[model samples]
Target: MSTAALITLVRSGGNQLRRRVLLSSRLLQDDRQVTSTCNSSTSEPRCSRFDPDGSGRPATWDSFGIWDNRIDEPILLPPSIKYGKPIPKISLENVGCASQIGKRKENEDRFDFAQLTDEVLYFAVYDGHGGPAAADFCHTHMEKCITDLLPKEKNLETVLTLAFLAIDKAFSSHARLSADATLLTSGTTATVALLRDGIELVVASVGDSRAILCRKGKPMKLTIDHTPERKDEKERIKKCGGFVAWNSLGQPHVNGRLAMTRSIGDLDLKTSGVIAEPETKRIKLHHADDSFLVLTTDGINFMVNSQEICDFVNQCHDPNEAAHAVTEQAIQYGTEDNSTAVVVPFGAWGKYKNSEINFSFSRSFTSSGRWA
Candidate 1:
C-alpha cells in the first residue's frame, strides 16, 4: 500500500491527510519474507482450514506442504450443572490444525491451539497483511501479553480487551526503538477463541480471519471482518481522523494504504483510525446440536460462504481431519492467499450425541447434556 508515513492517533479534526494523495502514487506491494507467521487474527471477540498446493509436499521455507497436527487435549474442565442438577466432569475430545501456503512465494501464515489449563482452551489464527514481522510477533507474544495482565478473579472479556490493546502498545514501543527494529507498517489480523470452564465461549477478533460455531449442521458466524469498506469500521476510522478511499478497482483502504481498519501493527495506520481494539462476542454452549467450532483465515472463508463450511464439517469422517478438509477445499475452490484452519470437536465419534454440553460466557456458567 501507499507508504505515506506521517500519521498520528490524535486527530485535530482537520483534513490533515489530503484527498489528492490517493492518486499521487500507485499502491506498492511489499514483497515480504513469506513468513510462516499468520499475519494476525484481530478483534475484541474472536477467534481456519487448509492446504492449497496439491503436491502433498512438506512445509518449506520457500513453498509447499501441510503443517497439520493435533494439539494437547483431554484436559478436564470442572463439572457443571443441568436442570438444577450437578453434571458430570467434562474433558476435551480433540483439537486439530491444518495450513497451506498456496501461490505466494512464501507462506506468511501461522496458527496454534492449546489447552492452557484444565478449564481453559485457547486457539489463535494470524493473517499477516503487510509482512511477516507483525504476524510473527503476535504468534510469539500475544498470549503472553494477555496472560501477564490477566487477574485471577476471572474477568475474561476485560482480559481480552486489555490483551489486544497491550500488543498494539508493545508493538508501537518496539517500532520506536530503532529504524532497523521492524517494519513500522507491517500488520496482521488475529482471531482468538477461548473455551473456559468447559462451557463458556468467548471470541475476540480484529481483521478478517473468522470463527464459526456449528450446531446441528448449521453455521453461526462468530466474528466480524475489520476491512475498511464495512460501514461501522468506516465510521470508527473517520471519527479517529482516518479517511477511507477506494483504490483503483474500488477496494477500500485506510488513507489509501492499508485494507483492514483494525490490527496489532501497521504503526503508520494507527493515527488514521485503524486500531487494535477487538469487538468480542460471547456464547454459552446450550445446544446438543453444538457440534464443533471451526477457526479459519480469509484464505478459506473468502472462497466459500458459511453454509458450505457447515456442510463440509458435517460430512467429515474424523474431527481430526476437519481442518484438512476445509483447507483442501479452499484450494480446490481457488484461494490465492495463505490458508489455515483449526477444528475443535465436542466429544468422540458416536458419543457426541450422548455427551454433556453446557457453557456460558458470563461469570456463572453451567452445562451438562448428552452429546448426541
Candidate 2:
C-alpha cells in the first residue's frame, strides 16, 4: 500500500478503537457533543463524519470528535475573592486529552491563584506528551515549588530555575517509588507565569507547550519550544543516541517519537542526556497593556496560533467565555487530539471582593457607643 494509504488505515483503526473505548468508558457527560449518524437501513445510530471524504467507507468512529472525554470544570469563585483589588475575578476552563495510553486521560493544563494582598496572580499550563501523570504531577506541585523557591530570598530568575529543577526531581522520586515504568515514561511540557504586584509578570517553561502574553493587541510569546530538530537540540539529541527526522512539514522530531528537547519525566528518554531542566523568562506588566495570558497544549496550538486565540479572547469580556470560545474554535478546526485552554485577563483586578465583614469584641460598650 502507498504510504499515505497505510497512514490513513492506521489512523482509521485507531479512531475506531478510541470510539469504542470512549462509549464504554461512560465518563462523558450528556451535555458534551458527540458525533452521530443514522443508518440508512436500520435507522439506528451510526458514525457521523466518521467516513473519509470520497472513501465510501467509515473513516473511523470517534467520540467527541477529535477531543478528549476529560474536561476541566471551573472552580467556584469565592464571593469574597470574586470582587476585590488586584484580583477582581479569575476564571479557568479546559478540555482535551492526551494521545492514547500509559497515562491519565486528561493532562493537567491550567493552574491559577489570585492573592489580593500581594496583588499577585499565579497561573500555569502543563501539556503532557506521553501521559497525564507528569502533567497532573506538575499541576499539583507547581504552587509548592514556587512558594518554596520564592520565600527563600531568591530572585525571580533564580526561583524559577530552582522550581523547575525541583519539579523534575520530585517527579523522578515519585516514579522511582512507584516502581512503575509508565510513571517514568510519561513526560509533559509546562509553561507558567506569576503576575506580581500588578507591575510585572514572570514566565518559565520546558518542552513544546507554550505561554503567550497578549499586550496592546499584539501577542508576544514568552517561552520557546525545545524541539529536537533545532541546531542545538539536534546536537544534544545526537550526543544522546537519538536522531532527528524531518516530517512533511520539514519539522524535526526526536526519533520521530518526541519533538521537544527538554521535558519533565520520560526517564527512559532522559538516559541519553535529555534532561528535564526548564528555560525561564520574565516581563514587566504595564498599564497600557490590555493583555491576557494564554497557556495551552500543542493540541490547541496545532490548529490555532497564539494571536488568533488572543484576538478571540479580546472580543469577550469574560475570561471563562473566552476560554470556551477558544476550545470550541479548536474543535471546529479539526484538531484530532485533546484540546484545553486557560484564559487570564490582565488589568481587571478588584472587581471581586466581599461587601461585608463580621467582627466581635469582648469588652462591654456603653449606650453612647463607648467601650467600658
Candidate 3:
C-alpha cells in the first residue's frame, strides 16, 4: 500500500490491533510497560513522554493511553428537554476502543446538550486531539456560551459567532496560569448546534469534528474541517509564522505538532495563531426532507462518510439503536481514537410535545408500538 494509504489504515485500524496486542502481551508477560518509538523525530509535547527516549519514564502511559482508560467511564450529559414548544426528543451514545496503535491512547470525544427555553435547544460535540481537557471544557461550557448569546428573537448565526469568540476568550484566560502550575498539553476540535423554533438549525465548528444533517434522503455538511494542509488552512498557518510538514506517514501536520488550523486549548501552539473561535453556519430545518442529525469526531470520518451513516440510520427504527450501531461500525472499521457519537432524530419532537400535553403520564415508543 502507498504511504498515504498505510497512514490511513493505521489511523483507522491501528487502535483495535494495538489493543489486542497490548492485552495479549500483558496476559503472556507480567510487565505492563510496552515501549514504542514514533516515526517522527519532532514529537508533540503531549506525546513526548510516550517516546521511548524522551525525558519521561519509558513505560509511562502517554495521552492516548490515558484516554483509553478514561473512555471506560460513562459519558455525562446535562439535563435536556426542560421546556420547549414541540419539545425535542434527544438520544446520545459513546464508546471507546483500542483498535490500531499499540502505543498510546490519543483520541477523546464528547457531546452535551441543554434546553434553555421553549424555543431553543443548545448542543455541542468536542473531539479531543492531543488530550481530553479541550474537549471536556467545550462539553462543559458550550451551552453557557450559546445561551448567553441567545436573544429574544433567536438568531443562531449571531449567537454562534459570539459564542465562538467567547469560548476562545475563556480558553485563553484559563491558559494563562502561573509557570509553576502543572499543565497537560491538550486540545480538542469542537462543533456546536442549536435548534430554534423546531425548524432553524445553526452550527459552528473548529478543527476536524463534524456535524451532518439528513434532509430529503440527502446528507448535508454543516461544518468545515480546518485541516492544516488544506490550501486555505495552509495559507493561514504560513501567515502566522508556522509551517506544515509531511511526516514519515506522509500526513500533514503543523510544525510536526498539530493537524488542524483551528482548535480549543493547545496552549503550546496558541502563539502560532491556532485560535479556538469556530466558523459558523445557519440552516432552516425542513420537515418533508429532514430526518436526523449526526455529530461525531474524526473517528467516524476515518472509516465512513455521512451518507454511509445516514444509510445505517435509515435501517434502524430507533435513533438510539442507530447510534449504537454507528459506534460499533467505527470500532469494527478500526478507528484509533475514542469513538463518540450523538444522534438526534428530527420528527420525534411531535411525539415528545404530545406527551407533555397529557401531564398524567409520560409516553414512549417501542419498535412494536407506542406505550403510555
Candidate 3 has a TM-score of 0.64
lDDT of 1 by residue, 1-372 (tens): 011221111111122132123212211111122222345434311111112342323222111011111222222212322122111123335666888997787777888776666567778999887778888888888777666655453867777888889887887887788585447888888899887765678999989999998765667899989888788889989998989889987899899888888988989888888889998999876423466788899889877677777667666656667788888777766677799988876522222332232222221111111211
TM-score of each: 0.70, 0.63, 0.64
Model 3 lDDT per residue over 180-287, tens place? 232335788888888775567888898988888876556799988998867987887788888888888788888788888888777777767677777888886643
User: Poorest 10 consecutive residues of model 2 by lDDT?
Assistant: 60-69
Clashes of each: 54, 13, 17
> What are the lDDT scores of the predictions, listed in order?
0.65, 0.59, 0.60
Candidate 3: where is the Cα deviation over 4 Å?
A: 1-107, 152-154, 178-184, 348-372
Error of 1 at 141 (Å): 1.2
lDDT (Cα) of model 3: 0.60
By lDDT, the better pick of 1 and 3 is: 1
Comparing 1 and 3 on TM-score, the stronger one: 1
